[model samples]
Target: MNSLFLAFIGVGMMAAGFALYSRFLGSKVYRLSAKYATPAHTMEDGVDFVPTNKYVLWGHHFTSVAGAAPIIGPAVAVIWGWVPAFLWVTLGTVFFAGMHDLGVLWASLRHRGQSIGTLSGRYIGARGRNLFLVIIFLLLLMVNTAFATVISKLLVSTPTAVIPTWGAIVVALLIGQAIYRFKWNLPAVSVVGVVSLYTLMVVGDRFPIVLPETVMGIPDRGVWIILLFTYAFAASLLPVWVLLQPRDYINGLQLFVGLIILYGSVLITHPDVVAPTFNDNVPEGTPGIFPLLFVTIACGAVSGFHGVVASGTSSKQLDKETDARFVGYFGAVGEGLLSLGTIIATTAGFKTLANWEEVYNEWSAGGVNAFISGGGSIINEGLGIPTSLSATILATMAILFAATTMDSGVRLQRMVVEEIGQIMGLKISALVATIIAVGVAFALTFSSGADGSGGMLIWPLFGTTNQLMAGLSMAIIAVILTHLRRPAWPVLIPLCFVVTVAMWAALLQLGTLWAGRNWLLLGIDVVIIIAAIWVVVESASAIMRARKAPAVAWSDADTDAPAPHHVG
Candidate 1:
């Protein structure tokens, strides 16, 4: 079948899900109301609590959550075949991730913009809140370490991407000044910012920048990872409007443009799907597709990480309660679209089945490399762009995606650590808290699994932990709904599904790690399982208590009510 046909089918399915299913979720399930005053307005503080435009907030939310996981997960999970990956990205985004994100955002909005980690105290009790904070801190730490390694490896392998990646940061800084300082029009600035970044890509392709292995007698990748964490530390310390928001806005626009080019190229080229829809000839030790595929494609389909981003940062900036549906649900749909593009690009971009098989024969060789080559081939054939330039552009995209995630992850980690400190009555400065967070991430990057392969040793835990986090967030939302006398099925159903799949996947991984005697990963896996159980038990208890207590006539839609106790 022609690649464009598959693209249309996938895109059409996602659009329909957004229109029909998501609309139903918003109106019937979530019942988003414009009447409620958001934290951004109620707690307007000119810093983290400033109210933001819906469109800009959507861009920030989407790009922050988009990260490298969506691309990496789908690209890797396509090993089973495109059909499974496509279905999951389509249905999972609509039913699972969309609801998860929207519900958490609403939960946070109703609770004074406190992150899910902190909100656990109100809904799940003090102990639940403490455990949730620990889980969130570890999850964000893993995110930082993993993405730092990912960005460094990409830069090392694709030297041409180095210049453009850094160039985009410089552009973002300028764009930030233009928008915030000079009050420049956002659309014009965004267009110029994106165009300038793409121009840098062309320049980079012609003059690739290669960094030396050692600045002063150190491994290059290690140095790069340290430099990245350093940047994250600084970026996290800056206010949201200064660097984080503007940078993510520019990157978000770049992603949209890249997707259009990719999908348009598919239409022009009409390439064939050389790979099969379902490949029964499996690798020897590959886990079955049932639970493994679900967890493997976490972000593309329905990542728990999205829930954290929703409740952690995005909820604080929302201008009104009703925008949660748009920012949360549509953000998920946007990720689903990206995943669909990955499926199409990987399955059909190659000229022959043998070439595709060779690239995908091993998981290590596939991932971002395969997607870049294959997607670049399609763009080259369709748009007459040189394959080298196309590959450079794609590589830059992957690097930026990872870098954006790292920036946001570091910031979230700092907030989590500080929250924990406050709960424990330890007075920690923002600088000290940020350093501690970055230090932990830096240490993890060099742990025993650091086999010079860019933290691949700890990657297995990322997906499961991410899904478990989503399950935990959804559990919190479910209990909150029950307390408010709202329908809890929308959130509860997805929570159960995520917890089941994640537990299964984690157990499977634990067995392998135990046999291999990889104590670090094995220990991490056990903690994840325990965390899942703790959250579920807490949620169940909260639900039972809510049932026995009198309904407090609490409506999230009430805009005139006094705000809850402010934490940060």
Candidate 2:
């Protein structure tokens, strides 16, 4: 079949979901209203909680949650064949991810923008909240640490991407200044920011920057990792308006532009999907298609990490309560589209079934590299862009995606650290929390050796870990809905589905880790499995408590915060 069919089907399904399903969720379920003041206004600090335009906020939310996972997830999961990946990305986005992201945002908005980890205490009890925080901390640690190595490796391998990748930081800073400091018009500023970013891509393609194998006696990859974490530390310390928000907003727009190039290329070229919809012949060591497929494509489908990003940063910047549907649900849709595009690039970018088989000969094969090579080929073939430039464009896109997520990951890590401190009755300043966060990420990054590859040591567990987080976040949201006396079926159904599959996947990973004698990961996996089950039990008990107690009044539910920062 022509890849265009997959593109059209995926895009159409996601669009319909966003248009119809999201509206039902907003009106019938969430009942979002502008009257409820968001934390951005109530807790406005000109830093983390500054009120943001919904468009800008959407961009920020979209890009931060997106990261490189949407691309990497689908690109890898197509190893099971495109049909399962496509269905999960589309259906999961509409029903699973859309609701999960939007619901968590609304839950946080009503609660004064507490992280989902903190919200656990109100609904699930103190012990559950601590366990929740541990999962969140580990997940963020994995993200910040793994992504540093991912980005550093990319910088070293794709030297042409280095300039545009880092050049985006400068573009974002200028965009932030223009929008906030000078009060410039947003559209004009966006055009300037995007143009400047692409111009750097061109310059980067013309004059690539290749770091030597050693820089001041540090290996190139190690140097890049250090630089990346240092930059993340600095970015975390800045006001969101000055860096994080603008950078993410612009990168979100740029992703759309990149999507148009990719999807549009598919439209013009009309390449055949050389891979089968379902692989009848299984590759050796490939896990069963059912649970693994779900977890493998977590981000595009129904990632728990989205819950983290939604509750951690997005809720705080929401200008109005009603905008959650757009920022959270549609942000999910944007990622679904990216994942769909990745499915196409990987399955159809090759010339034939034979060529595709060569790349998909094993389960571990196909990811960002496949997306870049194949997507680049499609762009070059359709738009007549040179392959080198197309590769540069895609490489830079991947790098920027990782970089933005690293920025948010570090910041979220800081928040989690501070929350943990609060639980211990210790007052940790933001500066100190950020240092601890960055320090932890750095320690993990270099734990294995000077090459900074240790970050990926626990990466085998990320898919399950991320999905488990989503499940836990949804549990918190469902509990909140139960308290409000609203129908929580929307949240409850996905909650059960994701948690079951994630737990199953976690257990499966335990077997593999045990066989391999990887005691460290095995121990970590055992702890996560135990903690997750404990929290789920506590959440179930909390639901019973909410049911037995008096239903919370809507007005009271929305306005019950004691203080801005102390709500959690």
Candidate 3:
């Protein structure tokens, strides 16, 4: 059978399994007896709270969960083969990610939209809450860095891709400015934003503006990193509707078209899939099917990062608590499906192209100009699309994917700064706090990995790290539910399993880097190991605290922590 159809069967099965796991038996996972439940706190206006519609909440939650991590992680994991990747994406979402996401959303809603970190304090323990926040901040910086790199790499291509990319950036900025500052109509401004981005692609085909791979003898990769950070700085400063959301909407269209083309190629070629499900040669291979895969595909699975979505922007805007269910749970399911589609493309559709090795090399070229040179053959053969257009389409998809996370990372960072500052009793001006946040964001973009830096290596690691955050959150939720004396089995079993796997994955990565003596990778490994240990340690401690603390029922709008760092 053709791989596309095979993919469909596999994905369909995986999805079916997820439903069975989530619905009939999930409450047992959450240990969800009403007695074990969190109180559904009421909302209020101002910084403390605001209500929003589930539709919008779903949109925000989905976009927040959709980031470079899911895309890159699955891509890397699938190198082992689509089967294992599919299995992890499917099973993990059904059992691990779905439960984690629902638990976080439900818990946050119970506590007046308090973030996971803060909720850790109220429900888990004060020290546990601070600890969780530290892990979160580190995870955030890594995420921002990875996505920025991903965008930079995607844009460093033919003049066609580069020009449209830069144009989109400028256009996104202008649209954002118009909407937020000038009070321009949202609908009209979004239209102009789309036109402007598309126009760059169209006009560039004629004028053909390109950013060459290198300038002043700098490696093209370095140039992309620098430019990426510079742009992230500005993008972070702007309002969501303008640059982030509008750009994502336009980019989402590109992702949609690219996926379609990829699926179409698979349908036409019907290539037999040869990729293995797992690679034994890399033994000591990315720790087996537990935390490793779960962590590697965090966004595609369940990400604690979404807790920020549940509590931050989405919660602030939520019109009702019931909306949290679909918005928080199902929207994540949608992104999981999207990533599954890409996995299908990579396994089934990709083989049709004659020279994947060559395409891989091209995609891995020295700078922006490198891919342009290698584009012709792959487009003609494997992808079976015209080079100029396919190149634009592919490049646009990467940019858009990266853009989604950029917004998420930026917003999370802001909340972190705000949250930590409040916890520390530091009264910093909002402007100065923003500057610190921006600077931290930029630093992440500049960091690198062995084969490549930016998004490629870092993002998968980011996924692993992100998954750890999810695992930690799930563990906290399970522990809290248990301590409160409620139905906690469903959440605990998978939550423990996922986190255990994730820890092994992190350990393996740390071992790999330590053995190789690769400085950048070594640094990443060192930091992740530290963070994971701290989170695990704190989580264990939190459960102990929960077991010990008298039932301290939560009240709405309670401001909090003893120095924010140790909260979660």
Candidate 4:
């Protein structure tokens, strides 16, 4: 089949899902109300809570959640077959992730922008809240470590990407300063920021920035990893407007531009699907597609992490309740599109089936390289650009995506850690909490694994945990729906599906880790399974309690007021 046809089908499905299905979800299922003053206005603090434009907020939310995981996950999962990866990205985004993201954002908005972790307490209990926070902390830690490792590895492998990657950061800092400090026009600054970053990409392609073999006696990758985490630590410590928000805004534009190039390339090149739809050349000990594919493609299809971002930062800045549909639902659709691009590039960009097989043979490393190569090939063919420069640009984009995630992940981790500290009655400063969070992530990144896989070694755990978090977020939203006497099926159905798939995948991973005697990962898997069960039980109990209690009337004032139970 023509890859362009497949790509169009996927993109068309997402567009229809956004226009029709998501609209139904917003109007019927979620019933978002503009009458209710959002926390951004009601709880405007100017630091964490501030009213914002929907378009700008959507950019922040989308880029923050659309990390390298979506790319890496689909890139890896296509090894099983493009069919499973493509189907899951298409269906999961519309049905599962969209609902989950929208529901959580709505629930958070209705609860004064409290995070999903804090909402668990109101809906489930204080114990569930603690459990939720712990799970979130660990999940964010994995995210930080994995992204740091991935970005460092990319920089080390593709030296040309190094300059553009760091150059973008510098550009982001300048953009942030210019917009906030000088009161520069955002659109103007954004265009300049995007142009500056891409110019750096072109220059870096010609004069690549290669690091020495050893930096302070550490391997180049290790040095890059350490340096990346150090940068993450500093980025986490900075205020959102100065760095996090503006940087994501710029990176979001980069992503938007990159996607246009990729999709246009696909349409122009009209490549055939060279990769097999279903391949039995499975790697030894890899889990089957049944549950693994769902977990593997978490970000594109339906990520629990999106729920985190929605409730964590996006909800706080939501200017109107009505914008949740645009910010939350469409953010998910954007991620699905990225995932679809990944599927198409990985499947069709290969020159020959044999070449594709050779790349897929070593699942982890090959998957990453194949996506870059294939994506670069398509862009080159479409734009008449040189393959090497196009590949470098794509690699630079990947590095930026990963870096953005790491930047956000470490910052989120700091918040989670501080929340945990607050729960424990510890008065740790943000700097201390951030240092602790970065320390743990750094340790985990350097930990031993086969062939020094580092974060890759525990990617399965990360994927399962991410999906489980999504399931848990859905469970919280379901409880909220039950309390409000609203239809709970929208949230409950996705919750059940994610929990089941995540649990199944987790068990398979536990066995794999045990057989390999990877005690650390084995223990982490066991704890994750236990945590999943606890969340399920807590959600069920919340539902039962809601059934017994009388339905509460919806009031805008009540939603805008701070909940007594909000610890974060």
Candidate 5:
């Protein structure tokens, strides 16, 4: 198929999924009415109660939802054929993703906009909340490390992508500052930001940043890990308005513009997907089907990580209950759109290339593994960029995307872990707290991307784990919607299905990797397997407990209704 045609089909499906699934049915399930929902939920001097606008809320919600997992998962899953990658992204978004996201926001609405973690305490009971926190804290840790590995590879490989990415961010920050502080018109500032991003791209193409010789002294992989850690630390300590939020908004804009450029380029060129979406035989070492494909293509379908975003950080900043459904469900649709774009780019110039297997193997050199890991580089050559430069550009894109997510993940993990630590009477100081958070992040980053596998197997684990989390979240939402006794089936059916599939996938992975007994793989498998089982058990218990609770009349208080009671 022509890459252009595929792009159109995939995008159309994504749009249709949002319209048919989320706008009409999901909106009903997650109902976001402004009047009944509290904004500040009793404002506090610091933390949890900060009032934020929908735009900035977009930054928090989107960056949370958008991460390294999407790019990596689809790239590897394409090993099974684009059919699974494209279908999972499209269908999953409509039925399952929309429900999970909207449900998360809906549950938060009941506790005066409290986070899912907090609501678990009040609604599900103390033990469920504790169990939820343990999963969440560690999930954030894995996320931080995974993204760190992604970025380090990108920085080392793609010298040119830096200037444009960082420049777009600086431009975004200045514009954000001008708008929020100086009271500039948002539309005008946004336009400037767009223009600046393009200019940065042009210059980045002309003169991308290269790593210094000293930095390059270390092995190509080792240098990347060190640089990534240093970058993560700097990013964590900075203020959100300056780099965090603005960069996110810009990233969203970049997502929009880059996708358009991709679609347009394909339309003009009419490039064929030269290689079949899936390879015929598995690579020498990798498995050919089923379990691996399910693990590899995790983000396209469902992710455990999204749950953390939905209930943990984004919930804290929601201004109205209704907005949560829009942000949560729709944001995922947008991310689906992103994965589709990467697929198109990989397939775009395939017609001219020979020896697809050789090209696909080269992708592992850098972060190109995330976008074109199993695919040939026919598209890269067709773009008129040298193979090396094309690879660098791809690497830069992944690294920047990973950097944005890692910064946010570390901060979130810090918040949750610190909260837990304080409750445990650990007496951690502010500086010590910073170390604890960064310490965990560093531990995860140390040997990441080391296997020359370029972060493929790990991605499925990320996806499965993330999906498990989302499933647990869906369970919470299912229990809540059923308790409310408003039209529940629309969301609940998908809810049950996604959790089952995701849990099945995660458990399968943990076991497979454990049997493989690659120690690093084993460690990840163990952590995630335990977490998934806990979530599945918690979700099942939540459902049973809620079902068995004494019946309440229609429109009973959301809080007074029984919470999912599974706990530590």
Candidate 6:
């Protein structure tokens, strides 16, 4: 099969899903209305709740939720075969991720932009809310720790990316100052920001910066990890407009350009699909593809972490309720396109089946490195760009993505920590909360000494834990819809599917952990499974209670103020 044709089919499916299906969702299901003033207006603080342009907000939302998972997950999962990974990315993005992301955004908007974890108490119960917080905290911790390791390793391996990767922070700070302080035109600022970012990439490619093996007695990777968390701590403390918003916005634009380069390479080169559609010969010890495939490819398809990002940060910055469709749904489509590109690069970018097999000899072999090398090759062959520059560009893309996500994840974790403090009858300041969040992440990263390899220890649980988080988020949305007496099957159906699959995957992981005598992970996995099951029970009960209660009449009137118990 021709890679170009497969790529087009995947892109076409996502396009139709956004164009036709998202419309049905916006009007008929979510019933989004511009009249609904989002928290950005109602609670307009200079810090976290300032009204934002939809495009800029979409950039922030898209890149923050993207992280490196979409690239890493699909790039690795193609080991099963391109057919399954491609189908799941397209279909899951359309029916599962689009609705999940958009729904969480809408739910948060209608409730004063409270996070899904906080909203759980109002709809589900105090107990459910507490458990939801646990899931969210764990997920954020995993993201921060794991991504630090990913970024650190990339920095060590691809020294050329170092300058651009860190230089992007300066570009974003300037973009923020230009837009918010100088009041420059947004389009002009955006063009300058993107061009500045790319220029840094080129300069970095020409002059690489390799750190010594030991930087003041710390290994290079460990030093990078410490520096990354330190930056994240500061970035999380700054106001959104100062760093978070602009950094994510520019990174999002740069990422789209990178995607176009990748997708365009496929169309221009018309490479052959060298890997099999379905691999009958499986690597020993590789788990069955059924449930694992769904969890492995969570980000590009459907992810609970997206819910955390949607409700936690994005909703607070949303200027209008209607922008949720674009920022939330279309943002999901953007990631699906990236994931689709990964599938193509890994499966078809290689020259032959034997070459592809060499890279996929083991279950864990194909990851971000595979995507960088393979996709870099395609770009070099198709566009006549040098491989070194292409690799630098892609490496910078991955680094920027991970860094932005780390920014938001740390911020969100800080918010969660503050929430937990409130529950404990203690007041936690933002600075204090941020210190705790970053402190925990840093401790985990260096737990196995300064090498900073400990962060990946619990990463194996991220897939199941993340997918389950998505299901639990859907549970919150479904409960809210039932209370409002509106249609909920759109959320409910996917809710059921995701929860079932994730729970199954968690059980499978439990056995694997137990067999390996990995007691720590096994214990944590047990807690997550139990918390998820308990939340589902609470949500089911909440839905039943809502069905029996008086139904609030749905309305699109401008006067529909968000009420604690109802929205009519």
| Ranked by TM-score, top first | 6, 2, 1, 4, 5, 3
Task: Please report the TM-score between candidate 3 and the true structure.
Answer: 0.76
How would you encode candidate 5's per-residue C-alpha lDDT over 291-322 as one tens digit per residue? 45544555555665666666655665667766
Candidate of highest lDDT: 6
Would you list the C-alpha lDDT of every candidate in the order shown? 0.82, 0.90, 0.59, 0.82, 0.61, 0.91
Question: What range of 10 consecutive residues in model 3 has the weakest lDDT sum?
Answer: 363-372
The predicted structure with the larger TM-score, 5 or 6, is 6
lDDT of 4 by residue, 1-568 (tens): 7898888799899889889988988887778888898888888876678787687788788888887888888999998888888889999988888888888899889888888998897778888888888789878877877777778778878888878888887888898789767988888998999899889888888888777887667778888887888888888877676777787888888888998999999888889998888978766755577887888889998888888888888899898899999999898998898888888889888888888887877646455677899999889988888898888878887888778777778877877888888888998888899889988877777776321247665666888899999999998877767766787787787788889989998998888888899998898889878878997898898788777877756776575534322123
User: In candidate 3, what are the lDDT values of residues 1-568, reduced to their tens digit?
Assistant: 3566665664575467456655543344332232322222243533324343354346446666676556666665664556777877766666666667767776665555578888766654666667777778877776676666666656554456677766776766675467546977765765675566666766665565545555676567667766665566666555555565545555544444445555555556556654454544332333455545566566666677876666655655455444555665676676676667556545443444334333333211222222222322233456555667765755564566666666667666777888898899987654566678767665454444321363444544665666677777777676667555566676777767767776777777777667877678668656666766776776777667666655543332332212222233
**Order the candidates by lDDT, highest first — what do you get?**
6, 2, 4, 1, 5, 3
Tens digit of lDDT per residue, candidate 6, span 1-568? Answer: 9999988899999999999988988998888998877788888898999899999999999999999999999988888888999999999999999999999999888878889998898888789999999989999999999999999999999999999999999999999999899999999999999999999999999999998999888999999999999999998889899999999999999999999999889889989999889988767777899899999999999999999999889999998889999999999999999899989989988999999998999886899999998999999999988999999999999989989999999999999999999999999999999999999999998999888998887899999999999999999889878877778999999999999999999999999999999999999999999999999999998888888878755454433334435322
Q: What is the TM-score of each candidate against the true structure?
A: 0.95, 0.98, 0.76, 0.95, 0.85, 0.98
Instruction: Give candidate 2 regions above 4 Å deviation.
Output: 556-558, 561-568
| Per-prediction CA RMSD (Å) | 2.5, 2.1, 6.0, 2.4, 4.2, 1.6
Q: What TM-score does model 4 achieve against the real structure?
A: 0.95
Per-residue alpha-carbon lDDT of candidate 1 for residues 441-487, written as tens digits (9 for 90 to 100): 88778874332343566777888888888988888877766665678
Tens digit per residue, CA lDDT, model 2, 177-217 = 99999999999999998889888999999998988889788
RMSD of 3: 6.0
Q: Judged by lDDT against the true structure, how good is candidate 1?
A: 0.82
Q: After superposition, how far is residue 532 of candidate 6 from its true place, in Å?
A: 0.3
Backbone clash pairs for candidate 4 read 304-470
Q: What does the lDDT read for residue 275 in candidate 4?
A: 83
Question: Candidate 1: where is the Cα deviation over 4 Å?
Answer: 448-454, 555-568
